[model samples]
Target: MIKSTDIIRCCASPHGIFWLTVAVLAIPNVALCFTERMGIMASVTNIVLPVAAVWLLMALGRRPGKTALLLFPLMFLAAFQIVLLYLFGHSIIAVDMFLNLVTTNVGEAMELLDNLLPAIVIVVVIYVPVIVLAVVSLRRGDVLSRSFLLRQRRRSLAALVAGAACMAGSYLAGRDYSARLHLYPLNVFYNIYLAADRYKATADYPQTSAGFSFNAVPTHAASGREVYVLVIGETARACSFGLYGYGRNTTPMLQRTGGLTVFSDAITQSNTTHKSVPMLLSAASAEDYGRIYREKGIITAFREAGFHTTFISNQRPNHSFIDIFGKEADDWKFIKEETERSDMYDEDMLRMVNDILDKKRAKELIVLHTYGSHFNYRERYRRSEAVFRPDNASEAKVSNRRQLLNAYDNSIRSTDRFLSLLIRQLDRSGAVSAMLYTSDHGENIFDDGRRLFLHASPIPSYYELHVPLLIWMSPSYRQMYAAEAAAVGSNSRKSVATSASVFHTMLSLAGISTPLRADSLSVASSSYKPGERHYLNDHNLPVAIKKILRGDEDFVMFRKMNLKY
Candidate 1:
């Protein structure tokens, strides 16, 4: 029973056109939920945010030109979602994804675009018409009359109230659900802000001598020629390793290698390399990550303990957190110039290792950061080295699931070769030496039907955090420190462990006594206890590691020892 005059006025006005554009763009937003196959309640709840956004835009876009421009942000966000959905088969804009697009170099960005060309085409097809429609609507001379403005001002206030009420209701229902609401531009904005703030915090963080002292060193400093090698791997998951009970023999070399102890329960503190590497290299934990980097990192401690510290990386040297620690080392070498390189394999770092070891420093600690099993898994190894054949040939599409798994397993096998060669080098050195190996973070390969394909989701998954930790020492080193070897062997099967323990354990491995060191956190000590491990996302949201691993939301346990976070 609508009047013809009223319908004509609505069609001719800029306010009406802007709302129409918003409504069209909103389909992609709500479509995200349906595509993910979320429950009816969750899908219905998600509409509340977009509806509020529509009204808020209507309030702000009173002017014709302003309305068109404002609509661009939402439309662009929707376009971005379309591209991601086509590429990853999902639309969860995460902190790592934001930084990779905005902060990474042009080449890396190009590589990413090149990999997802098919998805890009789909995005263009879906969004180009909408963009045209918006521009045409904006170019119109239509305006809001005095009467219309008065009415909209009132609607604007109501929309604001409704938005707030919707957010509150979502939060009251569940904190986790509230965080998961993927409202297009708002969610995108939150992730970008978090990435920028996090990077700034790391760069501008202050370091003081307040809690740092050199006099805390204990009397167990190495007497003879000793070498401590730490190999920091990239994107390796414990479940993929044969030693950790995987069906595939991904880590055949490690399984057959002697004098290697595998800690089955190890997990990383963060899922991204930027955050995880800092936590592993520095005495940082989930509770005090902001201020922990202010203290001197492990490299500084080793240098102070009269050991020649060296850092060699196969990955590019663009990471601020890693670069800061590397700068502190006596010798820092970067073998790879590009951030993402397909021609250079992880074995490239071995040349640097051999060169450094040739120097024969009496007491030294060398850290090798390798490009191990990063995405585009097929490119990580050479064409000749692709042992697992018929893997995914196109990055844009997973035409075959078994092929993708084969490619991933092949990359893992390449890592096994790299580690085995590294151990052989240490063995040949014949110096009292020990090597510690672990990945910065793990990768996600759509294990569940949920279609989660990568790390950095706000949601926590067990495979993304559970990483492999291996400790290998030469015969001479084991004989020299039998007690330490025994302790490591005894604690390999402990139910809980985290990268936070790396700082304390590295200090113990170097036999350097320091007040900052805690024996309870060290795996090579009788008093060692695998205490409660807490996992955190880029937004600083906490998830109980134990609860998630057990697939139980409500499980409680007590800690036998107190360890500072």
Candidate 2:
């Protein structure tokens, strides 16, 4: 009566069913984990990926009912992600930095481990739903049979062994590669996948020194202007300017100016904000800035010139750049209001600057950093009462890209309006006023490809890397610095000047004697100088390949056509 075949089949069936249930439950829990951390939603359309992946695995010799049944949800999530990319991928870029993860490395991770019990407590708070799902699955008894377990035991053990091998192989990788494992998401793989990418980029992107002393530093010691205010704008690309030949009239007020020296070809030292802002404010080129920034930065040069230094910003402060300058500055101010309130705009920052200018000395070095055109583009724009564009426009007209650019341009336009206000106020104050404006880096909208979004994702395109460098001198400063101003044409012919030159330029304009970087400093005493002020490379060049990485297919299009820079 003990029919062995029938009994075996029934048991195997229950085991398979239960195993599949647990697997299904596990995926959503993990996916929810990622989603909670990241905030992505799911839909039926998203299901195809997991299904296909299951089938593909089956085809690659897994089980049809079991393999797919287990892998389906995650497959769906990843698939949906790819599909979403296919649909709206036009404006997303993924990026990571080695310095960020590596600098404090083991110390931080160890501290996290030191707090492991607390972290586990936090995980418990988050894992409630997963626990519920597991409990629900447990209520339903064995869904797999003995035979099925016997069959899968060998495959499962082999898979576990292979996975262990991969994990060990990755962890055993180099420390630099290993450091990245401490980062979010990428750490799940223990930095195995992203480590290679970091290595390749680091090796390819060796830093260069800033010409702070006799070379790249530009000297500007004229007395016509009582004060010069260099407003270093952040992440603004030059080509988007109507003044710079963009069809969009993005810089209407700026272009109307008679005295502004807008360099059409200036570029940032790097595409990412981390790389660019520090270089602009310090004496290091893209090549060497990272190393030297850990040392004394541009503020020392500015301060030595007898100018009071004040850094005001809304962006998150990082260790190796303009942010560090603030910590080193005589006065450093940051407002949480910028990050918290949606209604709070750059104008609020201007008001703060105005207030500071109102109460104290009239001619201090006030640096204002704006979070212009940063991501979540929708959030950046002021709430519109109504549509600015007519109904005839589709995405090409009212596209998210254009909308973000509009928000950024509107902010710039506001900056222009404010500058006009400040100039009038400064003129009344009897102090020279000159404003130098530049961005940390430019943004990459849907311009380049489906692969990346924002500035500094890959090698970084000039669009995202190149920024706007606008200089407005008060009448007095202009008159005093006349010879310096007259040296460059109203239409100043360009040089391949990077942030390394900016350090010297800032000093030269202020008539400061201190060097930012001995190698990158240059004086623009006369504007006709055409030379490589300071260039950048991701890495040391092999003798066989002296090729420059500046004009890759992605960056070449941005070089000639006028950008906001």
CA lDDT of each prediction against the hidden true structure: 0.71, 0.49
For model 1, give the 10-residue run with minimal summed lDDT. 553-562
TM-score quality measure for candidate 1? 0.84
Residue 84 CA displacement from its true place in model 1, Å: 5.3
Candidate 2 minimal-lDDT segment of 10 residues: 539-548
Q: Per-residue alpha-carbon lDDT of model 1 for 1-565, expressed as tens digits? A: 9998887467445765656565667767676776654444445556655666565566564565456556676667677777666544555677766665544556555666777777677767655655554566557655667677667657766765765666566566654554434455566788878879777766664444346654435345446688899888888888788887788878888888999998877878787777777677877776567645467678888888888999887766665677777777998877666445548888988877898789888888999888787777777787787777797563645455566677888989999999999999999987888988899887767564444455655444566777889999899878988988898899887744456788878888778888778888888777897777877655665556654442221121112111122
For this target, which candidate reaches the highest lDDT against the unseen true structure? 1
Cα lDDT tens digits, model 2, 391-465, are: 121122125555545555555555555555655555565666666677766776566444334544434555665
lDDT of 1 at 565: 22
TM-score of each: 0.84, 0.61
